[model samples]
Target chain A: MLLLSRHLDQAPNYRADVQHFLFGREFRAEDLPFSEKLIRAHVKNGFISLRPGIMPLNENIFDLLGIRKKWLCARCGNRDQEAFAFCSCARCGKKCVYCRHCLNMGIVRSCTQLVTWQGPEPGFDRAFLDGRPLCKWDGVLSNEQQAAATAMKRTLAARESFLMWAVTGSGKTEIMYPAIEGQLRQGHHVALATPRTDVVRELLPRLRAAFPDVPISGLYGGSEEENLRAPLVISTAHQLIRYAGRFDCVFIDEVDAFPFHFDPMLEYAVHKAAKPGTPFAYLSATPPSELKNRFLSGSLKGVKLARRYHGHPLPIPRFRWIGSWQKLVQRGKLPSVLHEWLKNKMEAQQQVFVFVPSVSTAAALTELLQRNGFSRSAGVHSEDPLRHQKVADFRSGKLRLLVTTTILERGVTIANVQVGVVGADDPIFDEAALVQISGRVGRSAAYPNGDVVFFHNGKTLSMVRAVRHMVQMNQEGDR
Target chain B: MERCLFCGEMRGDPLSFHNLFSPEYAPGFCLSCREQLVPIDPRHCCRLCGRDLSRLDRNRVTEGTCSDCVKWANSGRNGLYVNNHALYHYNPFLKEMINQFKFRGDVRLADGFAAELTRAYRRIVHNCVREQSGILKRKPSFLLVPVPLSSERLLERGFNQADVLARQIGAPIVQALVRVRDEAKQSKKNRAERMRLRATPFQLNEKAAVSLSGHKILLIDDIYTTGATMRLAAEALAPARPDSIRSLTLIHG
Candidate 1:
């Protein structure tokens, strides 16, 4: 009887530890540190809930229609039938379905139980919310930036979604500082998510410097720092799939970038990561049509800043016809027109960015340039193991001409770098992508104007639209 | 509407009478992903090890067998074990696929290789029937015995990769062997060290020994590197009096 009383007394301590680890996260039951008996007791006491990792989509439908059955992954919100496969499970000793989409995170099989905390919310240390200024950024925001930042703060404080429809190089990251600071001042967790890893890498250092005393965690594919309880999380959207109802305010930068716009699973991840009724701040140069339409109809509150932080108009691209460049590249010769343009840039001692449509093109072009006396040129792509080192070399002027694919089109800022697009008419370079590629030039105030040339084999509608988009934005900046 | 299991692109299979009339199978991979896999050509492979002979050096090949098989034959370790038949070359692409399947614990990737494994198993059965003409007039029925991992290793990897591959053959499996010693991974050992290692890590399962009498055993595994593992496993099964032992693997590195 005495031992039973002591065990009962220790129950609250175990429950508190479980609550602390699982308060705002969804984890596989096997991943939890506690024993099965403890977890079961907590589940029975209404302090935690258990759910199947993968569930059948249509349990009530009969098999007479000859339709294939589908399953859903509760963790990643994956409903694609192809992403699920059946195997004889080792743990359950039965045929079980597992989600292949998020397999890298962990194998989520049908028998796998997902655990989440359901009891009263755990208390957090609110000592940081002493009402001092959190953002230490001393740089002044331009008039347009100031106006948009103020509007963002107001809408978020009212618990409403806000979009910053700003152009590239328009101080988008700086404008987010005030809003993020407001959330952190209230001891609320904030997450700044982007679709691309390059953007996350670029924002981590800037955000860390702006708020030096705050603990921040930057998450990407192979990032080693995994402080889940950090108040500020800067992560790629893919990493947010592991979190659940953790953030009070979520900021999505580059809202229409790749994978996020192409794959609905990432959108589901961001939605699942934030608490219910959490406000979202979207910052984008070229917003997708759905968000654009909502903002235009006045159903969603947003502000459009056409002007860049430097108060200069966007660089308009010039088109040049280069016939059959692929054949010339295969023949180990550079296009005559492109050769002359590169020669001019090199003679003026300016760095250049030559963007190709595919990885193979980047390699072949880099070799062709090197054989023709441009020894300082190099190529980089997403799969290159030395991608970070190569980009660093380019920034430090170790490589004068950087040959790259679309992976370098965003989140890179180099002063006075001239941009060249090889095969710009390819379908890969859509209007939004072309605009972002052109935005790479003239990013710094010291070199506020640079050349952007689109060398194409034939004119494409996307090219025309991209040019028009820039022209319209420049006109808006003038007004 | 079918998509590649690896790349997520449309399979885009060309329309043909063979595809339209035949019962459809689940899509494995798209054309590009399929093209990356290099199958071993039977005409140009080492007769014993089933390794692609074209990539081997001229001096390494004596008649039809590679140097490694000659070394194995000279060791006198092939008690009742026959030669191994490998389906594919261990190129970087297959290595990456296997890494994802084995180390990363993505067991679903085994589905992509189901058709290839089934076809290879049928070819092995046909060869066995042809070789043992008088001893086995009819096609021989074989039992699959996947190479076993130590208990600790099994718990760490969640599932045995050989067991997953063996299930694709649709053959009856018998757990007749258990690993007695947990050695370091075979991939980490040098060729000389692997060949010099004398002690066998496997032992016959006493409970399943009765079922193995007079049965033709085909040991299944993901890769056949030095052939030492197969010989050790065959030696372990000698106590059960199996009729014969041969091996099948996905790749011969």
Candidate 2:
């Protein structure tokens, strides 16, 4: 497992302690038996953590936990009959391996249960989705998105899991509407889970408008809807801590964001919240090639919606290198070119957000900007007490210019704002941050175009690649 | 032979030295015979000062945790534990008698700890219990409550480790000290990371803390760590501005 760690093929911050099941008992790789097929299977699954080896408990799980078997399959009379077959796994190539029948769960097995919470709610209805309906977009769906929706609708009709590989502005949200609407129509509960609170807030009104008569609640940390009695619920992924499979349609928006991208529990939460025959649709701009490869192998159903909602042009980013900011700052000065850009914008009454590599640098730059007679600028970092207030001020124009770290990059948007990234060449700034930060610009159609400047002294590959990717996604939409 | 102090069994878990097993000169033990291990009453011990309550070499029984703890009579967790209101001597009485109560499934030992604590708190608890008691001794500044077992542990044990002891002292106990980051169970962590781990993991209850503004605090915990837990707890409760935070632990080791 450390061999994988050595590759450092993933992000540098990705620390998978392969040593976790490492000591304690002499269990080691090459010691246990996983057929090449099993290893290949999990490798293809992408998120597996040498998982099968961690049996957690091996005895008759009921016998191990000493839990009573409270559930009996109400179907065919065989007491030991297996649960539903993958029948046809829309993921993993399945000939029809049914889940162990007696597991036709939702039955409380308190006696043999080792874990406190039994995952996967047994009888969740579509009514849960009624609480927070799918968002409403007051525009026509692009033909690509319409086609994608029709396909998703058909897959749900057949009970298959699908992956949606739509570009950032490709109206993936609208395509999700049909699936959510179908589940609501079936009277099954629906849950739309995303990785960001900003997106959840953005969708609250949209979903409320789309499913006007249904009960809906936005679920996130500090959210008001813990007593989720609705048919639809919109929640950030982490909020699912209180939930498990209790919904018929689980829409995982932005399936590739932090924590959610790496956390195994989230996958567990999604599976637990989804009912039998429920469909999971991963909505994302970049379909981490691992998932895309799975689709190509015919294991997962892939649908591409290469169209934006308003068909609005994606704001393409152009890069400028303003290298080694620490050296420049050490001289008690701002790089003149970047200084000129900021001065020009402020003079024009335009609002601007500057992204820095780290919190310390963000503070330093905020001080610099404020000292330069841009006194209205304020720093936004996790350590700051009034972060949400600062964001609100930026939005209301109470703050003419705001200096922030990457915290506002992905999830926050201030309307009609131009973007600048100080020291974008710093290794900390990467493809995802750049794309999401650039995305901060050109939010609305009338104000759809905005400039993204990577104020770096030397350009990094991630910068060039991020800009190229944005252009590619936008160009792909044109066709 | 030393009689089993707990369960009054014939066998016990301690080795008997000439005076060690004797019930008289030893300040009471015969741990095996009593069916209850009473923590050996510490002697020559300074009560106001929680040091060598026993004249015995303290070093022989427990190793000093760090240079700081080794040199000082107590880690002196800030001024919070200036008096170090520690109760048990960590003797056969604590090991056997308390475990019998704590794990053999009777919560009565906690109450007994409380009773003994009341004996310790004769001056403080009495005022709190008296008529119009609250208005009586300035209401103990504000309360710097103890860190609790995570929710998982709470469900398993049915109660908090610090709550029972805190409630016994008649001190206003608050459950506001929260474990924000569910740290991996640190039972086995070493000193340094354990110290760093404490910082990122703890937080104060917002409402209880704000209310504590300008008040004195009684920080309570069931057991003391390398003093890392207490130090971190104090930081988490910052901006609440407790006039002075004092710590109380049932056991020091």
Indicate which candidate wins on TM-score. Answer: 1
- Per-residue lDDT tens digits of candidate 2, residues A185-263? 7776778888777678778877787767678878876677353447788888766543433577788887777657665
Steric clashes per prediction = 0, 60
Q: How well does candidate 1 score on lDDT at residue A137?
A: 91
Estimate the overall C-alpha local distance difference test score of candidate 2: 0.60
- Candidate 2 differs from the real structure by a C-alpha RMSD in angstroms, to one decimal, of 22.7
Q: After best superposition, candidate 2 residue B115: deviation in angstroms?
A: 30
A15 Cα displacement, candidate 1 (Å): 7.1
Each model's lDDT comes to 0.89, 0.60
Give the CA lDDT, 0 to 100, for residue B97 in model 2. 53
> Which digits, one per residue and each the tens of the lDDT, describe model 1 over residues A1-479?
99999998877533677887898888999889999899998888788888999987865547334477778899999998877877776677788888888887778889899998888888776655667787889999988889988899889988899989998899999998888888888778899999999999999999999988788899999898687567999999999987888899999999989989888889999999999999999888999999999999998899999988999999999999999999999999999999999999999999999999999999999999999988899999999999999999999999999999999989999888999999999999999999999999888999989999999999999999999999999999899
Clash pairs of candidate 1? none
